[model samples]
Target: MYQKKLVGVFGDPVDDNPSVVIEQVAFDYMKLPMEYLTIQVKKGDLQAAIEGLRAMNFTGINITMPHKIDVLQYLDYVADDAKIMGAVNTIYVKDGKLYGENTDGKGFMRNLRNGNVPTKGKNVVLLGAGGVARAISVELANAGVKHITVVNVIKEEGERLVELLNSKTSVEATFVFWDHKYSVPDKTDIVVNATPIGFVNKEEKPNIVYESIHPQMVVCDVIPNNMNTLFLEEAKKIGCKTFHGMQMLVNQGAIAFELWTGLEAPVQVMLEALAKVYGD
Candidate 1:
């Protein structure tokens, strides 16, 4: 008899999470006797859920939403990069100790490469300065992007991210106050919306000057649930290349997949699984 291991993700509103499908499909394709679950962990209950993971011997987990930053405190040790990034999206159990790591930026880069999106020497503009934005901005800098512009409603948060990118990476980063209708610089090659604006409410979109976006720009949204957001819709109307959040989700899930099972994740199978879920 083969003993099955356990793995999953922790988030508050996990109803539409597709990572379980992505990982489970890969596990089945590889004939691995493991089970993947997406548990609904409410706000203020993260510590308890982490304790539960320890008690139940979960092989690993991916934390999302409001818990990513808070989960760091519960981990036994974290990767140095994660410490600098100030966030951890993946954790694996080793010798009953939980070790934290961040795969968000790397995963996003993989998504870009797999999608054939160009980033080298490209000026990028990020619409938010949260964990996802920070992760993507750092990787964009590492990829030798020419410059980065961080736009956020909060001055302090945006300034801190700009400072981090400028002082740490070799990328010239600047901050911009997100005016009611923020305009994308004409020279920007890549535009990313890494905010929660269209999250709980799919109908909502970020306040931006949609007309300012040029046709050659690559527009991206990290909102997993609403792949075709209003921003993307507007970008499409302008003949801009638009990218969905599912791509990032699949890539990031693949990273966690390998971390948890110590096997090369069947990315093709996971992509197909996601395609079916997304109905394409």
Candidate 2:
């Protein structure tokens, strides 16, 4: 019998994180000798947390919240994509060395591709300038998006993201200071709410001009637990196709599962597990 491998997600306020559930579900389904854990490492103890994982010979770890950016310094290697995004959400151990990767953006890109949503030369608008937004923007740029507009309530953060995109990639990027009911530009091809506004309250969403959503455009939100957020609902009311965060969550989880175990992830099984947990 193979020795059980230990995997865990480390973060403060870790109670609500779904990674443990989905990852453990995948491991159970595959009958892998692995244990998934939720570790509450306070922000100040992240360095110690990394060292502890190293000492424990853990198979892998998922970093979340305040640790994503800081955990980079402790890892042995970080993928180029995670370096560009300035965050690392997933890490796997190989040759006893830690490797960091950002699956958030790739998850969105994969979900879009899976749904036959094209990003090549498409004009995209992001609804926030947070960590997930950074990851998605880099992936969008690499996928040949023609333009990106980041809208945020904070001018500095939004501008920083736009600057990173414009300088680091060929994608033409701009930042918009979000105040009042921001009108979606007529030419927008895809609109994504990368913010957390809808995570807690399904009825609350980003303050965008819902009437401006065109039926031809694709709409997305990143709030996983509350999959049916008001943002996507409003887009549907406008006759536009929309989807919430379940796909992104499961896709990202699946990616991590593959990287850690070197086996094909049961994507559908993982999706069902998350859906049941969220009552989706």
Candidate 3:
């Protein structure tokens, strides 16, 4: 029997996340003598928290929220993907060195490919200008997407994302100011909700008009819980294919688990864990 190893997620507001609960389910399913825990990290204490994680000898830590970008400066090394995305959502310490990686973009790609959603030469409309949006933009552009249009209530943020993408890849990317009252472009092949608009208790749901979404369009939301987000529901009503963020979460977690343990992640076990926590 293998001795139990420890792993977990760190962030404020984590107590309410289904991901934290699902970690427990993973432990039970694997029966590999592993334990998982969630830590509530206060603002401005990310470095200290990371140092404490090292001291505790945690196998790995999942970064979240404001800490993702902030923690980058503290890492000894970062993967190229995380560097390009400007964020880190997973960290692991090895040989007295802290390494960072951003699994969000690759995880999203995995979900997209696994679900058979086409991306090559497709026109994608991405909602929001935050870290998740940044990751998705880089990944899609690199995957040979024909065009990407980003929309955000904050014009400056949207423009900034477009500039970053243009500098990184030769893909045609543009930014547009979003007026919540209007419908999104009908020419879009994929619509992604990367903002928190559809999160639990978030006041405004995604503002895209459902009537404009065609049956051939693919709609995806980065919000995991409540799989039937208003954005997804509206898209579904229009006969559009839809995806929740749960697959992204699982794929990212699997990568992090592999980094921490150097063992192939039991993906089925992780999926079972998520199903137990969120219900299939």
Candidate 4:
């Protein structure tokens, strides 16, 4: 007995996207006239899907994976941060114009703040130079991080990310070869895994060394499919504060929610919903 407002996530292989459940739970808790879905849009069909969302008066939609970069071409306006990262994960239509923004970095920062992890004047050892790494590194630099050492299997990509972070921001950044062993430098305050290493298969082992993690640092992984990534488990074993992958997933969705409805997102509620789905 209410009006219907449409919102959803767009990506290939989106059938298991947890955003669908968490977002719908928030909408229901707030009693908002909204429904969330996981729309599977193949790479070739991205443009048509975006156009359809706008033409049909959809509120806003979250972009993911292969579409994050391609979807930027269709937006009428892109936020400065999103343009800087060369990716867009959230899109909202307002005044007949579609606007794009990247909430992944901000979402990760919010997760850190919620967990009481400090960023200013800290050293970070980041794994991977992909999209999630780019977003997080940009945000960390903006947050006054002292220095960052990025490790990646691809030397070119890693150097590119370091150059971008060093040239564009105040953070001193460097690239290191990732041998998939315990090579983390001393005095590092944060460690992040932004790669897809752990998502390949259940039998696949973690790329980062468990013994190298110090108890004084914070370890984070961007893979959300598995809540207890081996990296996190290793960090916990060492008594280091660990941030789960789902934290960023839920926080990013909450940021998108705030952008769409202009309402304070119930972050804890969203976290609970995610835990229910992933069985935390």
Best by lDDT: 2
Error of 2 at 24 (Å): 0.6
lDDT of 1 by residue, 1-280 (tens): 5568889888875665788789899989999888988888888899999988888889999888888888999999998668768899899998889999888888888878877988888999999998889988988998899999999999999999999999888899999988678888899999998998877777888898888999999889887765688878889999988887777878888889888888998887887788777632
Candidate 2 clashing pairs, residues 3+ apart or interchain: none
Kindly list the per-residue Cα lDDT of model 2 for residues 1-280, writing each as its tens digit. 5678899898876665688778998999999999998888898999898888768889898988888999999999999989988899999999989999999999999889988999999999999999999999999999999999999999999999999999889899999999879998999999999999978776688888888889999999999896678888888888887867888988999999999999999998888888888855
Q: Which residues of candidate 3, in runs, are more than 4 Å off?
A: 1-3, 202-204
The C-alpha TM-scores of every prediction are 0.84, 0.95, 0.88, 0.92
lDDT of the candidates, in the order given: 0.87, 0.90, 0.81, 0.86
For candidate 3, write residues 162-248 as lDDT tens digits.
Answer: 998888786798988986655768788999999987665634577766688888899988876556777888888889889888777
* Residue 7 lDDT in candidate 4: 91
Q: Give model 3's clash tally.
A: 0
RMSD of candidate 2 to the truth, in angstroms, is 1.5
Better of 1 and 2 by lDDT: 2
lDDT of 4 by residue, 2-77 (tens): 5588998888665567888778888999999999878888899999999998777799999988889988899999
- Among all windows of ten consecutive residues in candidate 2, which has the lowest summed lDDT? 12-21
Cα RMSD, each candidate: 2.9, 1.5, 2.6, 2.0
Q: Give the candidate number with the greatest TM-score.
A: 2
The parts of candidate 2 lying over 4 Å away from their true place are 1-3
**lDDT, residue 92, candidate 4:** 88
